[model samples]
Target: MTDAAPAIAAAGLRKSFGALEATRAVSLAVPPGGRHAIIGPNGAGKTTLFNLLSGALRPDQGQVLLGGVDVTREGPDGRARRGLARSFQRNSLFAEMTVAAALMTASAIADGGSAVFWRRFDRDAARAEAAAAIAARVGLADRLEELSGNLAYGAQRQLEIGLALATRPAVLLLDEPTAGMSPEETRAMQDLLAGLPRAITILVIEHDMDVVFDLAERVTVLDYGAVLLEGTPAEIRSSDLVRRRYLGERTQ
Candidate 1:
């Protein structure tokens, strides 16, 4: 493994909603191109930690680092500009827009261009090409002309990832990408994520234990708003602490 600085790092992060302490001194470090999964019980502050990392919510204390540079103060847009992108728990799509149009719009925005209309593409061949490439990468090339809302639920999720990929992000944060998916859809999503190049560092929050174990090279378990354990899947599965706290399994 290379010794490059961590692609994403959280140092002593904390967040509170007045009476509720959502995150308590949580910290993480994900190496470049690493596939890391965060698994936690409900109310364990997974979402809160995600928000702080994405700049959606500022930490009440501590710092966020991107490629070893402090970015705790940067907003979401700023982070995006510096190669960070995220997909939410719910699909975020331009419902009325065609897949091609939506992808083009996202690509244009990433490049600091006016994404007013796809019809006005004569002068934006680069944007169009980038969008097409992203479509192929996300398995949406065949659905380019289809309305985003009209695509199958799984396809819609694929498009959601495509939108994020359009930004050409170096680091991707996926929040429950398969939350509402069927077993088949979940498998497809897993395959899609597995096929992603190592050029992108991935961090995911997922409820599906199978998905977490399948995709993650390293796993972090959270309980009561703090890290309970971190290790390879085998280590975590064998840990009585993780089994009791997060997996809810009876352990000897």
Candidate 2:
């Protein structure tokens, strides 16, 4: 594990949609290269919190810190430039484009080159370099010609992650990456996520406790938009509050 300071920090974060409060002065930190999990019930403000982190939605108060910089007011692109990136749960991708094309597009953005438009991909050396590296890293090398939409659901999710990785983000925020996946696919995703380069930090919000405990070095439990408890997997599994509030006890 990396010993550097947190790659991302949310201090006293708050958000609201009119009278409904989505996030209630929440604060959390993911140390550099840490495998952190944000576990919460539905509507516990997980998605809302993700929006705040990625600059998709501005917070009502507090600040977001990335690489020890206060970027509370920066927009999405600005955050991306600072090595902050994210992947959506809803499968964000270009359905019509082949995997190679999609990856090459990411390569363009990463290499800071012009995007391909109405032309075949012949030899954008820089983009090809980045695309080939990312595709190989994500195990999509063979599926390069497959259209994104034509791939299996798990493959689509893999592409989504591959896109995020193209930026070479120092910290990656994943919003329920395992949602709708079968057991086999879920395990595969877990393995892929776990094997990520140690230089990249990961903060994930997931429902599968097994996956959470398996991947996260530390876990934070939230209920009603407030943090309930935080600790290692062993500590959280034995916490009374976690058992009562989040994991219902099995009746005798």
Candidate 3:
């Protein structure tokens, strides 16, 4: 591996809740501008791991590094300020707000101008332009005027992604972006994600094998809160350990 610092790295990470060990000495590295994925069966601590990386939860042990800086002590807002952003598995949009309004809010927050109540967001040319640009990037330009809650499920998910991009993050953590979707919708989401600018490093936790294979350059399999295996997509597909432990006969 090159000596360049990773965009995100978890070193000997561990976390627990009461007696439950949700993460156990987990470690992984994501190269700058790379597409990496975490996959496993339910209860494999994928979400918990995401929480640690995004600073939603502090690890009991180990360190989280973003762009080579130790951010283990940073909170979610702190991480975001350092160009780390995350999208949840559920729709977290403002249901009553229009897509434009929501995106403007996100852009303003990320730009550290949320306190500028003296000027209307829509009237701010720079913020409005940035919001419109992000909306187009995520394929939500057509729905700009629609109420976020009234959009189709797939559209809602698109909005979620748009919000994440609005932060102009250097590292984005996406959890189950396609959790529930029709085949057509899934394909659309896949295309949208695939088209994202490679300047932004993407780390995704997804259950769909097809999606994982289609999007990730590297795959990390987790089991019982620890990394079971890590390899290229081809290596992961061919590994007997992964097949037997996770992918099953279908991968064979």
Candidate 4:
């Protein structure tokens, strides 16, 4: 991404499922190298917006631009190939796959080298080395042999982030990485996220106000499927509407 261009730009985004309008003409920008947080209550269309941005779901009307390309119509895989990646609120991993195995498989898929996983990975040592490196980076080296389902829930979540990182994406969309985590686990996740290189942009949908304020350089508050406000952490803290609808009239 260039210094002057936005990493992600959404314009007039709208989505409807049956009778409910999930997103209503919402728009926002995640600046280059920015850690931007999206916060809203339940049913505020937080996940739906992520789906639109990540190409998991198409917007009924609008445009999603990544870097400079208009990618509203791109499917998930196409967007991924164009340097977009995301993790969901639920840990999306092969529950039966070992950490090392899962990372190898992910690296193979994301690298776009081959579909013959067993022949390509088992014969090549570089794939194993790369997968191990990614596993260690996410603090899962110790659990390399553990089945994904057998690991703790927080560990599973960490693995999901690791999988997204394996894609070498320019923008990483995190859909509540800290959701359902214990306080200690959440802090660990926050540290891992903060320690990431500044070259990568992270746009996160987070409900934990503490995490948002601690990690996000900019904050976007969504209420009732629209951008209620957008500002720095301090500005968000002082906003009257944010206080009433999301911040509970007191700083979190």
The predicted structure with the larger lDDT, 3 or 4, is 3
Clashing pairs in 3: none
| lDDT tens readout by residue for model 2, 1-252 | 956567999988899999988899989899888999998889999988888999999999989999779999899889989999897332334677777777776655655655555134436667667777777776687888888889898878888898888778899999999899999889878888877898999999999888899999999887888788989999999998898888773322
Which tens-of-lDDT digit does each residue in 96-171 have in candidate 4? 6777777777777787865455445644688777767877878887888888778788898998888777777799
lDDT per residue for candidate 3 within 1-252, as digits (tens), equals 868799999999999999999999999999989999999989999999999999989999999999999999999988899899997333444676788877887787788876344147767888778878888988888888888889899988988999888889999999999988999999989988999998999999998899999999999999999999999999999998999989993544
Where model 3 places Cα greater than 4 Å from the true spot, the runs are 88-93, 115-119, 249-252
Arranged by TM-score with the best first, the candidates are 3, 1, 4, 2
Clashing pairs in 4: none
Q: What lDDT would candidate 1 get against the real structure?
A: 0.86
In terms of lDDT, the poorest run of 10 residues in model 3 is 88-97
Q: List, in order, the clash count of every candidate structure.
A: 0, 0, 0, 0
Clashes of 3: 0
Question: lDDT at 208 for candidate 3?
Answer: 85
Q: What TM-score does candidate 2 reach?
A: 0.91
Better by TM-score, candidate 4 or 1? 1
Q: How accurate is candidate 4 locally (lDDT)?
A: 0.83
